[model samples]
Target: MNIIDNFDTLHRAATRKAMQRLIPLMCAIYFMSFLDRTNVALAKAQLAIDVGISAAAYGLGSGIFFIGYALLEVPSNLAAHRIGPRRWIARIAVTWGILSTAMMLVQGEWSFYVLRVLLGIAEAGLFPALMYMVTLWFAPNDKPVVVGWIYIAPALALMLGSPLGGALMQMNGLGGLHGWQWMFMIEGIPSVLVGILLFFKMPERPRDARWLSAEEAQALESRAAADAQGHPELTSSDWMAALKRPTTVLMGLIYFLNQVAFVGLYFFAPSMIQQMHVKSPLLVGVLAASVGLGFLLGVLILPRIHRRYGNDCAFLGMLTVGLIAGACAFIATSSPAARMVLLAVTAFFAGGVLPSYWAIAMKRLHGIQAAAGLAFINTIGLIGGFVGPYLFGLAETVTGRSDSGFYIILVASLLGLLLVPLFAKAIRRETEASSPLGNGSAAGMQS
Candidate 1:
């Protein structure tokens, strides 16, 4: 395969300009992704009070979505690989949109549980599907930056979802629907519209993008393929082979460790803050939004940090910083403002290191292999998504303190810092081969 001539020298402006068209769409999709999933967090206090769902039951419902999400991941990824991303992604968005809207209809614990499961089923492989699409557009060295962009979607979601959710909750008795109902109705519409947009506007591959000139498309495709040739495991389409890789298992572990802290804290952030004696929905929204803002700020500065610090140093450093900041929550237990600042600091590190972690993972997988490997990794990691909230709720129930659950954040950060280097060491040769830092191409990364 002919590598794109001067891929090492591709102009940063050229690459950025090309991606500018596609990433905004992805960011929008991710905005919907997190919004639909976590909007429930915002609605939790009112929904529980209205529907008589217990704390444990609510946690179960929140986490149950990931069960369906995990179970169907490989299958969904295989389907997406076979059918193409536009159709599969659009299909996911529309179905999940319907389910998300139907959340307003939840009348009891069982209804809430059922809808959560269904929502999970609808969103099963969305992440892997999008990851597969990214491999088609970007080179290995570029995947981290791309990963950062996708996450900015969630960061933006928090910024928007918190305020929107708070405001909508004030609309109680509108059309005989609660404010939470209105929130669901309004938030769910954007997803369906995005689905329609995906079907009509999203291209299956670079070659199919009408807006990209032939030279641009070829450059993207050639560079992507060139990176894959050095490591077939990085882009192979074989799902079974992907599942069997040791690295696949390790990457999943890393994600699981990370999520054990992040997702659980996130799922209950608003109500937990309320437990600090703060009652205003608008204030809760603002505080929650700050954590997301921290995430966005971290991602915005990440590429520069990675360039300056090297990926390994940058990765471990963020975890250490987050660990210190997160543990401070226990110290600031009485001060809501201090707690928010600490959580925001924790969010910064969690968000900052994600791209580097994904960059390492993507270096070893691409295409169908990437699809299946990512699905498997995500499937396992999402166990944390399920476990985090439920476990937090259980812990909170047992300990009689909402803040008790947040201790997991520090534990997770410590584990990640300790385990990541070992995982990287185990795959030393592969990382060296694919890592721009190892090959002295770090300066060429953005280009």
Candidate 2:
């Protein structure tokens, strides 16, 4: 075969082998993680009756997790960097699983809020640490798709989790537990089991991947080495130096905007659907889960769009889709079935933003520096998660309309759309600097 054909073959073989070993388990873990977090949305009605959680209190309890998540995020990621994924990931999953199960015992607002916070603290590092871990296992160009594959977790969580939570709620009074109680109790078990598996089976790096053949392992290592040479700043082991980079701060802000737009819609989805005259919790959960359909399309479509349009154009497309769709969803009347479809379209773009931006950022960041940078971004960005749900809830409370929150989501999406160009420019400059043709160094770029 010619060189181009030969390279394609090798790339395909390596990707297939590595992903076989990685995606299923990673997706499963992420699935469990997202499921535990978002199931609260599904359990909202039942929990309201059981614990007397008002809309405001429920919003607080849901949003408070991110407060703890944001606070501990950097520390947890750094610890993961220091301690390795096997131990740290296992600890995180198990602890969060325990806390999630304990959510069954919540008697009032304070208990609910406290458990949510503890759950956040427990789950803080999983996203960024996993992002860093992807750097170890995949090439820079491959990270986005890898990250996209893992995002199926959220899609699956919403799709399966909503209905599952609803079904579990139907089990109220079985074994002397409310259905909401049963929902938390049963769903939390898989995480604990997944944590045990991670301890035994998780590989810290490609070098530790026993599943790969020797040739595959060497190819992975060489790809990483080449990436290290291309972006020396990213290869730095100093977490502090990574923190000092202005790109880190910029990416954090970008992540924050994306989270604000997306999580606002996500956390409030079931209620949003319910307001459309869907009374069955099970049916509302199912329709709410349709956001997963949008999410699935986003993840699958982004890589192809990026390859064709380049990062800047691709980001614009993603955000523009969000802007238009979110605006339409905002103006949509509650009774139309079309409202749900528009909301899904909004979700499509909102869901794509994380993988889209992370992919852009990962092209510049790698190694432990990638971990720390991702942590910094995710830490600050998660504050948006807290803000999105809480503020969305507050808006709904004040307006006495569940649909009023769509305007908040639309505003957040608009801000992200306007500012993403700046983010894209920063990335462009960095990519150009990192290019062989350009005078490449991030020295002056530091704020």
Candidate 3:
């Protein structure tokens, strides 16, 4: 019993050490990625004046990044599996950073679209690669919380990036560059530097981490192996089968709808706030940061809820509440302050969904399938990243009302809410089938 106790202590120590060493670095890297992705929103009005980009064109340019992203995601994940995440992620960050910085050179719509797509290509596979790394380094029980931490990067990016982007935008006419140009240049440079940091700092796997003692490393590896036991590594032949699984497909669809609401808000919230007659760029950014703060609160609050209610309960509950908040944004259209408040409320609950969704999705995936399946789901869902912005743009341009686009958010949220029951049922079934006692006995026990 003492020996067992000692082992448990060592395991906990290793997990703690790994989290301390890794999570911050990973979050920093992802924070840069998301900041670069969405900072375009802050630059939209300037782009229209300086670059002749229309609302529709801006939407397409903002979202077309995902087109390049989706195309390369699977290939990139497979390559990461082969070459190691440390190197692959560094390559992605450097290339995307270079491209993000180059946004300063946009001469017209074509250049804008091309640069955004290239940036997407450069950043492709990053999220799934990070998710794959989590599977390699952490045990099943620790994954949801770990993923929750990783998801915080985007919220932080928005929370901090909005204000930072605003401040940078104030750099207009400094050194003969527009404020947006300055924003891109300053923001993009750090990612390249961070990429360099990652190449040197990131370990390929838990067993390779020099910070961990040999016994601790062994404990981590043993825990990971045990976690992977039931879900065997998929061979190439089984790759398509794994991707085609009903649960995977359903989760992808759910994420797609969620992204429709989430990404739309990410790309347009600044403009939406601008429509509220608040003319100052910095003020718009500061107000926009409120949404990020709401999201940050949600991400921070979810793990406690998860601990108390379990995964399914936490996931469905947050998603349902989030969707409701999102739908209510439509009703707040008459009041700018109310609209902003609803947007933040929507973000707060929406923030919880990503971590919770992945927490459940990760359980059904292991080994090579974890990489492939994650990329596949992300690829499908990211297409909505494109759809959301494009449709919102189209809606706004056609109707000439900024808030009119909330109709899309309303419909998407309702559709997402309707699908939650189906997703919950599927997850329960998968969990039952995978348990030690098998599906029949698990069902019997539940009954």
Candidate 4:
């Protein structure tokens, strides 16, 4: 039978079984990562003075996490690949858990900075490693949805964290630990427990996956092989080669710009809500959760939009509109309700880019190269992630206006609109050159 016919025979349960096992762990880890990172922001509204740090100094400490994360991303991902993902991921989990517990010792800015850096180092490889695992297990057609599903954890984290994190911190009476300390302790422990559970569950690859019957494995593999046009295996040297590609570099730059906007918005969303004179932490969390809900809806809708309009148009179209909406939201600070609506719209549009971009990355990379390529892309992107929060904090410090720095984000988002068209043309040219008709006439397409 041909590939499509073979795929038609797949036991849906077998295909879904891995996902059922995988999605929870993926969500838990990413949720914990975001919770750990952003919990500081929520805590800051009340805890900064109690913790003996100025607001500006806390911002500096927060920004320090991404710096360590940015520096370690490539090497950590490489290590995850070399030492094997199962053990490596478990190690990252356990180490970060301890770091989370260590947050209880944050008596001042110095200790917070140290623990943030440790958290960064622990989380450095996680997303890229997950992306690499996706390439091994899911077929291309199924991949986008799965990626979107896994990537939704960030959104879910925001949704859950907005209210839940506040409540956890509000539980300061237990043994006299502060809310901030509880935030770390409670969120951090789950990762270690999940890590231990994961060892018994996660398979290295579909071929080795014991959960699937022989027929189920063959069915999944056949679809993947057909979609991927034969699997490309990668050695250590291949990882190096993938990173050297011009397209990879360009994608990295795009990812960098994207994260600047993403991380900045997330790190400050609760604070922004607070600045609008919403004094209740619970209320601020609720508004933030609204944005997360919008994000969740967008991910569900984006794939269908891409199928109809093609990737470039969909990306550019949404981002262009999102930038305008976000700018207007920031500028029109007169009405808090209006600002919240616009922010929700911006979050919705911004969330779509992730899964589509990951799919694009996977399309261009295969095998072990996917891990390193994603790591390199993220490493460059994380420089922006590092810079984003600091930029906002610095601008706020200098101007005494939080809204002023959003202009910079608006400009960055518009520039990202331009990059999408360039990416589209590059993708099309890549397709044509690799086709039988074009030959060496399009030699520049050789990535």
Candidate 5:
């Protein structure tokens, strides 16, 4: 065979490997991404004396991670867009791993603050880059499930990582190192290894895959072309225009409010369990794991629900149910059943949101336009993401009760409930005005 034929054969093989490679890679990295992000939660609860950080200081430390994360969020993603995900993602993973392991050295509030900030900086690119990669590789029809799968990472981390975190933290005999320090060291090391592995495995883009045949590459390129038809070429102006759109703004607001509830619960859930008279850190981990179970179930079920009710009804109904259940949980903190019910409801809704959000965005946007749009939405959303945990911690410090944070979440959930309707109205109008594409196809993605 000629060189051209050899290239074609290789490209085809690479294309075939994409889905299998992509899903597992995303799952593993994000699992560590989450574990690294919340190792501090475990640390705060159990390593308090070891770390020498106060509760209020802990909240500040938690919130500062997001500020650090927020500072670089857009820029890191933009860099990923410019440099491609493989190298940038590897850099992020390795950097976070080093910083996370260094948490062992933190002896005071200042060191903890510095380390958390570094962790945030390390994590900045991950989610936006993942979303960007998905847009590059998957068709709009296949996006919901793929995105849903990626979104399951955090949940799985909670389910699996939580118990593991508790166990590692109990490793105080492994030198003079504290349990909390070990938590960071153990959680962060695997990410560094994964980063090295990513260098070898993850492709820069679909076209860069050397294992795909010419026919396969052409097919993938064609699918991308068809999806690009209705969308304007991605430009700075286009990005600005998308942001200026009332609809985009509405979606951002809704996501922001939603994160306030979701992120707050995640950061504080362990502490909440600890305060509920559950003396065992392992037991607290188990309860938090339940939320993770809810998340997995939510992602698994959203496709069927979407097929049944359509995106608009599915989303609005989920938010409404979420708001009600969230409120009940906050109000009935004394009742374990009520609190668990609320946490499950919240996780389910949170889990389902990413898939629907991506599905809607994919149907509406394509190419770099989708990447920029996801970045923008996520950037705005992280504002709340950053705020939620800090506010929760701060509120708990001030009030001496962590339940106040949940009540705050209850209010934010209501805001999310209110915003979803407006988003639906605007989206419906946009769809009606434009040529609405129905459910996209797997073939449609590879067009």
Candidate 6:
């Protein structure tokens, strides 16, 4: 018993050490990715005025990033699985950074579209690759909290990015460039530097981590191997099977609708705030930063709710509440102050859903299925990232009102709410079939 207790102590120590060392770096990497990806949303008005781009055109260009992203996501993750996430993720960061920086040279709509697509292609697998790394370094029980930490990057980006993006936009006349141009160049540079840092700092697996002692590394690896047991690693021949699993498809659809609502609100929120007659660019950014606060609070606080209620119940509850609140916020009031408060409320619940959702997802997938399957799900869902912004843009163009796109948000949220039960049922069916005793509470599936 003492021997077992000693090993358990060592295991906990190792996991704590890994989280401390790895989560910050991972967060920094994703922070830069999301900042660069969404900073274009802040640039829309000025970019349109300067380049003669219409609202519909800007929306299409903004969303076209995800088309290229979806196309390469699975393949990029497969390559990361083959080559080690360290190398692949660094390569993705550097290339996408360069492309993101090149946005400074956008002379017209076509150039904007092309660069956004190329940037998407470059950044394709970073998210899932990092998720795959989680499987390698941590046990099943550690994932939800760890994933929560990793996801904080985007919220931090949005929070900080708003002020930073606003300030950069204030640099309009500094070097014969527009404020938006300056914003892109300045924001894109850090990703390249971070990529270089990742190449030197990131380890391929627990055994490869120098910070961990031999016994600790062994403990981690053993835990990981145990997690991977019973679950087969994905291979080329069966990759399609993993991708097409009922659970996989349903979760993908849920994520699809979620992104539709999320990206629609995200891409347009600043403009909506602007339409409220707050004229200053910086103030718009400051107000938009409130959404980030809501998201940050959600990511931090809501997962604890999941731990209390369990994954399925927590996920459904958060999504249902978030979607309904978000829809009502849009429909209930046109008052700027009230609307901003509601927007943040909507963001709060919306942000809570992701960490819980991914936690549930990672539990169901293991090994390369965790890598490729996560990528496939993300790929399928990211198409909505495209659809959301484009449709929102089209709506705005037709009605000449920025808030005209709220209908899309309403429909998408309702559909997502309806799909929750189907997803829960699919997860249970898969879990039951995969368990040896025809019961789903297998050791491998335990949270």
Model 5: lDDT of residue 309 = 49
In model 3, what is the error at residue 138, expressed in angstroms?
0.9
Q: What is the TM-score of each candidate against the true structure?
A: 0.90, 0.92, 0.94, 0.91, 0.87, 0.95
**Position 362, candidate 3: lDDT:** 75
| Better candidate number, 2 or 4, judged by TM-score | 2
* Model 6 residue 179 lDDT score: 98
What's the lDDT for all of these models? 0.77, 0.77, 0.83, 0.72, 0.72, 0.84
Decide which is better by lDDT, 2 or 5.
2
Which tens-of-lDDT digit does each residue in 1-447 have in candidate 6?
799899989999999999999998899899999999999988999988898778998899988999999999999998998999999999999999999999989889999999999999999999989988988888767777888888789999888898789889999988789999999999999999999999999899989998999999998877765453345444556666668788788878888887877787778888888899987888889999988888888888877767665456445655666768777776778787888887777777766678877777777677778778889888987898999999999999999987877788878878888887777667667767766778866332233
Residue-wise lDDT of candidate 4 within 36-128, one digit each (tens)?
777777787665657777656766777778888888877888887777677777777777877877787888778878888888888888788
Which lDDT value does model 5 have at 276? 78
**Which 10-residue window in model 5 sums to the lowest lDDT?**
438-447
For model 1, the superposed segments whose C-alpha errors exceed 4 Å read 1-14, 232-237, 311-314, 317-321, 329-333, 429-447
Q: List pairs with backbone clashes in candidate 1.
A: 234-364, 234-365, 234-366, 235-366, 236-369, 237-368
Q: What lDDT is reached at residue 31 by model 4?
A: 70
TM-score of 3: 0.94
- When superposed on Cα atoms, how far off is each prediction in RMSD? 3.9, 3.2, 2.3, 3.0, 5.3, 2.1
Better of 2 and 3 by TM-score: 3
Please, what are the lDDT tens digits per residue for candidate 2 over residues 1-447?
A: 897677566656876788887788788788899999988898777778877898888888888899999998888888987889768888989999999999899999999999999999999999888887777777766777888888878987877888888888788899898888998999998899998897888788776787776666767766754453364434444767767766677777767866776787788888888777789877887788778777877777865565445444345545666555765655765546777777777777778656766766666566677778788888889998988888878988898777777777777767766665566556557656656778644432321
What is the Cα-based TM-score of model 5?
0.87
CA error at residue 218 for candidate 1, angstroms: 1.3
Candidate 5 residue lDDT tens string, 93-203: 999988888888887889888988888887886887888787777655566777787878887887787788777866876887777767887787899999888888887
Task: Tell me the tens digit of each residue's lDDT in model 3 across 12-85.
Answer: 99999999999998998999999999999999999999989999999899889999998888889989988999
Question: 3 or 5: which has the higher TM-score?
Answer: 3
